[model samples]
Target: MSSTATPTVEIDPQTVVRKVTRNVIPFVFVLYIVNYIDRANIGYASLQMNKELGLTSQAFGLAAGLFFIGYFLFEVPSNIALAKFGARRWIARILLTWGALATAMGFVHNDFQLITVH
Candidate 1:
């Protein structure tokens, strides 16, 4: 009988830690900040939007409610796609798409526009 030896690979713990800290940590932190900012900016705008748009209580409620709906619908798929594609490109795409939508929101002239867009 012939015996075959398997190749073994060795990695240093310090190298792993250094790579995580230098690469993964900063990317994760930036993504977290971007995610937080994107989620909160709507609330900040809502404060002024209610006044500027002369929105009723119901309209304000609807607007806020719809944001969650859109977020819920998109979040899972977007995140899955991000995981598949890698964070750099995926997050950039997400930011650009949401940023355009957010900018368009400012131009909405009526409740219908808000509902449709959100």
Candidate 2:
């Protein structure tokens, strides 16, 4: 009988870290900035939207507050989903879903609709 042998390769941890940081960090940073801009855009829209929707300041405030409340409630589960689904799929799903919801916001006619959309 002949003996069989397998070869093993070693990886450099620092090199892996450097490559990950270089490749991933810039994309993550840009995504964060875009997300911030998207979230902040509602405030700017409120100038025209409040009058058009006939939303009282309090109602608008509540609607705005609910966005963050929903975010808080969903954050942990979303992170868990990201871990389960992997980043590319999870992030694409998030972007598509939020993009649809953002588009839907433009069609809302009243406080109830705005609240529901948020």
Candidate 3:
């Protein structure tokens, strides 16, 4: 009696690595590029904003730089909370915070208002 079995093909490890790198690296690179563009856009916007709002260069720079402080303050707490609450709920919380901040941002007229919004 003869028994037939389906063939199993073995993929080369380097080929698998190369395929994954090709697929994932493009997405990562694109995301990084987008992030860079966003930061650059804000910097350009700040130039116009400083004049319109009558903000001194130092005041505008201080307000702009404090954005990183807010991120830094929240990031660690967010990661710890995410570990406890899971991604869905944690992400919703983050989105809610962002939405509130964005809504408040619309009302900002001066540097103090901008700094205080968050």
Candidate with top TM-score is 2
TM-score, model 2 to reference: 0.76
Which portions of model 1 miss their true places by more than 4 Å? 1-4
When sorted by TM-score, best at the front, the candidate numbers are 2, 1, 3
Instruction: Report the C-alpha lDDT of model 1 over 19-105, residue by residue, as the tens digit.
Output: 889876776676677667756876787777778778887997887798888788988998899899997788677666766776677
* Colliding pairs, model 2: none
Superior candidate under TM-score, 2 versus 3: 2
The positional error of residue 81 in candidate 3, measured at the CA in angstroms, is 1.0
Q: Can you tell me which runs of candidate 2 are displaced by over 4 Å?
A: 1-9, 13-30
Can you give the TM-score per candidate against the true fold? 0.68, 0.76, 0.59
Clashing pairs in 3: none
Scored by lDDT, model 1 comes in at 0.77
**lDDT winner, 1 or 3:** 1
The TM-score of predicted model 3 comes to 0.59
User: How many pairs of residues in model 1 come into backbone collision?
Assistant: 0
